[model samples]
Target: MQSAQCSGRTLRFGFFEVDLRASELRKHGIRIKVQEQPFHILTLLLERSGDIVTREELRQKLWPAHTFVDFDRSLNKAMTKLRAALADSPESPRYIETLHRRGYRFLAPITPIREDPAESHANFNHAALERAAASLENDQSQDHPKTGFLLSHPRPPATWTWFSLLLGTSTVLVCLTALFLLRVNHSIALGSSFGNLNPRRSVAVLGFRNLSGDSQEAWLSTALSDWLTTELSAGEQLRTIPSESVARMKIELSLPNVDSLGAASLSRIRKNLGTDLVVVGSYAILGEQSHGQIRLDLQLQDTQSGETVDAISETGTESRLFDLVSRAGEHLRDKLGIRAVTREEAAALAVALPSNTEAARLYSEGLAKLRVFDALAAHDLLLKSVAKESNYALSHAALATAWGQLGYDENAKAEAKKAFDLSANLSRAERLLVEGRYRETAREWGKAIEIYRALSEFFPD
Candidate 1:
């Protein structure tokens, strides 16, 4: 906890000063355009400067009991908005620094004005709040085109890294495929307003219950959650607890599935993980006579209230698992009103599915293993992927990262070069990732960081 006794309920960091009572975030005496969620997030961060504020702490304090929200996504979006207001970067965060899968910390020196809570609110400066609200509304009303959601799709979104039907085009085509891989956090059913889920609630996707009674299918629990989290990774639509974080928790509890979670368990989850949305579901084999058919019962609930904000059920066979999951992912994306580049549009842009699903699967698993620090496994998988499909640029690029992790500088550089050579047809988003890798492998730290900064800004997936 930060002391407010030094200043009078006003906190200053860098060029920005946040009057806690006024709920106004201003730079150089002018208010910045920030919504309530972003402003509140900044205020909370300022209240705990220098110390790390866990994602759970933010949810506990700011989100009310019964506040249905997407805490992680909201926090990320708010942080992004705050950074934009402060002219900061994640590559080199100036004020708020992410602690990877842990949480965030305020990096700048903060000047706090301590004052009586009653006194501060007595002089709340409603005028400033009004000004901020007005600025936000004005910005929203302006002609700035946001890629809003489309409601017509039927397929659930699959994890971009995993299930998008890959196309074996040129290296450029491979890069383009990577661009279409929008990360998903979690899925929620859409209502009339498309604003039902608490936009700023931090969330966790617990393992879906495997009622199939077959231990072989146990991997579905974590894998499905991981996929949903990846699907929701576009921009800042939802804050998803990383699989590694969730895995750590699972290791501690040894709880089999989310269906077995009790109120006490739920409370522990909320406290330990700091989640706002509890995505818990169950899956069962469709019929004893059926070989591969299964059904998923999924729902997004308000952690504090234990209320189901949204829910959906989908059925498919093992052969169509990818399609089923992708449909669910797409439904969640649509509910959130985020626009995705359609398959037709992508095809029109000359993007085709990779020729080998197995290669694509290897690439996906390699990336996953790499995320969990199992670089050796990732390296092996990446190698196999490229060997299976020699034209798989993503596999090569990922292999470069795995090699770098294992201290194989020469191998890393060679793989990176191969990726770059194959990237002539990459979209802006794809080019940003490959170019940054190219620069980094060449030891151009300045260029790599600069490109990464731009990539973070332009393509935040």
Candidate 2:
């Protein structure tokens, strides 16, 4: 039996006819599988031909007042199956169009072979058209009085005027639609190339959640995210938030489960960190690390819009963790439309890196805290790190920055000098940062600005 909503109607469009009275679909003269859910979705799509049906709308329509775990995944599966049955390709659809991160659109023009007089086609702008139709009916009433006739006196005009007005309005609408499509296309073209990344956008990479049952892997979560931050910072175009700032905010806000933070929490954290984007992800070590694979899932959320702009997932072996981090950073930059930076050796550390993982971790934490203006904690941590390893140049440089921020000019200069003298083997970026701090303390504005400018140009992130 056919559904009562579309009862006694045969809607025909393209090569198909949907006979609502019999609940049957025909291509030429054959019948095919039209499952309950897919059939209903098909009708909904047919109703709103040429307009996007958002995932939220579809969820409400399909699963309203029902319990369904992972509705998004289910919807995607349904769409795939529906497309397969229809012989439609999402990439080059003959009937349906898939809009990324949004919803689906029915592409075919709908035509009713016979009208039920009871059911109206649900479609894009249907309500607007209904309202327009009612307005037209009212204007056609003989009892109505015209207020804005655009004439000094009442006079009869030829039917040509009405035709001309209708034609002009249609032409305007078409032009506007064309302009909108052009803009969308241009945006698609400029977005997410293989190389370009958004240079000015500040990104904060939060700790990736470890779904593996082993508590020992907790440090790996922090370590991997640190590596990701480092990889992204290498591009110069990406300004990755220091891990210290992220940890500070995470502690203060009591956001222990940063992985599951909603948009509100993410936005608050981003605002506190003064970053444009917040990158969060979860990871799982499938089976034993010695035998299985490590999987990473990442999301790039736009702080201003609170919308997830990009999502990337990778699976690989533990030994190639660095490779995954590098690829993640590259994809992140590409998503932001930033030009692949030809970063000079500025990103390398000027000093010999600390060999002790704990010391290195402390340095990273202290530097990140200093980035967020928490000089006291940074100073304490840096002091501890240097006590453990006296020749750690990066730690000393960060300590110097802390001293400068705290108005200890002489102390800052001393630390800066020590850092620079010890930085012969350090990365150029670290050396320049330390040099810039000392120049500022010396009140050499011109020299300081010059160094700062060079750093900015060479190491944008």
Candidate 3:
């Protein structure tokens, strides 16, 4: 462990300085905006500089037993914030180095300043006086008797005093002007590089849980979640992660079908799927089973902060489930401050979706299966869906994916062609997805990549 006696309480590294007593970090003598947690972490690392600081050690020091926090996630976020403040990188570290599953170590060499804080100001003044005296001697000739005057006398003559004041004032002006330009340039670079650090928030709509207690209606959970995912993607300002991506992540992470999650699970989703917000929901059939009412409950969660941003509950009948989806999605977008759907856009979406509820259910379940690589199950469900509604372009496209994965090349090609033939009325994003699926099934890898790249560019998070 590093000792204050070995290196004074004030430590300097690169162009930055850390004052342990003040609990402050400064770059070029200017303080940086660092959060309390990150600042504390930095102090701990500095105290153990050049040694590995185990994550367990940090948790004990930083959080109390009753903290009730996600230690791993909190530590990772604090490290990220600390790295940002230092403009450091884990990949090519200049100050802090990560040790994979072990811990982190500080890499920079530290220099200690004077132990006596009281003498610091006097030391600075003495240096400045020396420089000023040297300047006077250089300006005057050796024969000038006053060359050693500044060194001999504690105070300078009035004429020399005026000269020193003028020099000091000019230096201060130059320094201030330089600092101003540096700040302006830094602001401009940040704007151009990160667009004020606000990117389009990426959202993932998880499969809703079935609370109706009827196993037959399990498909409705996937269907409603898929519907909301599509509707949310209609907005240009929100980047909705594809249902396939969410399904794959669910299977990979072994996440349960639920309306809510703990902070650790949410953090995993955010990191693995690159999602900012997650929409977890549940649906139930109420009152009567024959022509029962349906209730949809959705909660928008900020994955990073693990906070509920908004909750929406919509009630409708089975026949108007699609309408309920539209209403919930609209409310969700509104809560996010995204633009409302236009009439033309809404019309296109209506035309693209299958009007038959049976077809929608089969298609949703089949798509979910396909995303999880359950090729045979997806193939059977998708075939039944297309039989129910032959012209459902998305169903055909998804069928193509299922068929391709099942190694039925001929059937995949046929479904791909059928999807393209029926895609004329599809939304722009839907059309791109169909075309990319078609390219993939046809073995046109390059063309498929180009189409997917276009999709990502259009919806970039």
Best by lDDT: 3
Error of 2 at 401 (Å): 4.4
Please give the CA lDDT of all the candidate structures. 0.67, 0.69, 0.81
**Cα lDDT for residue 161, model 2?**
79
Compared with the true structure, model 2 gives a TM-score of 0.42
Query: Which candidate comes out best when scored by TM-score?
Result: 3
- Show where candidate 1 strays beyond 4 Å: 1-223, 234-278, 282-291, 304-306, 334-355, 364-368, 418-438, 459-461
Which residue runs does candidate 3 get wrong by more than 4 Å?
A: 1-198
Query: Candidate 2 or 3, higher TM-score?
Result: 3
Q: How accurate is candidate 2 locally (lDDT)?
A: 0.69
> Could you give candidate 1's per-residue lDDT for residues 1-461 as a string of tens digits?
44643246677777777887788887877876777876777777776777888878878877878999877555655655665556554545678776755667878887675665576776677767988888766665563437333234366667652444453335668776666553222222233324443545366877698787777565566456755665554344566776657765663444556653456777777877788777778988877677777788887776676667677788887555555666666766675566663664334223212346566567767765665445567788889889988875656888998776555678888999898887665555555677789788889999999988996555333
Q: Indicate the worst ten consecutive residues by lDDT in candidate 3.
A: 144-153
Task: Give lDDT: candidate 3, residue 165.
Answer: 93
lDDT of 2 by residue, 1-461 (tens): 12333433777767788877677777775776777777778877877777788888898888976675688656765765566456554435789887765778888766666554344455435887999988766765634456522234455577877988899999999999999999998777756432353456788888788788576556566657777776666645667787766766774455663454577886788779989888888988888644868888898887877888999998876665665666777788788886553444223421245655566666766765554345556677788877778787767877887665444568878887777677776545656777777677677889889988997766544
Worst 10 residues of 1 by lDDT: 182-191
lDDT of 1 at 452: 87
Identify the runs in model 2 with alpha carbons over 4 angstroms from their true place.
1-201, 210-226, 239-257, 266-276, 283-296, 313-324, 334-358, 365-392, 401-412, 422-431, 440-446, 453-461
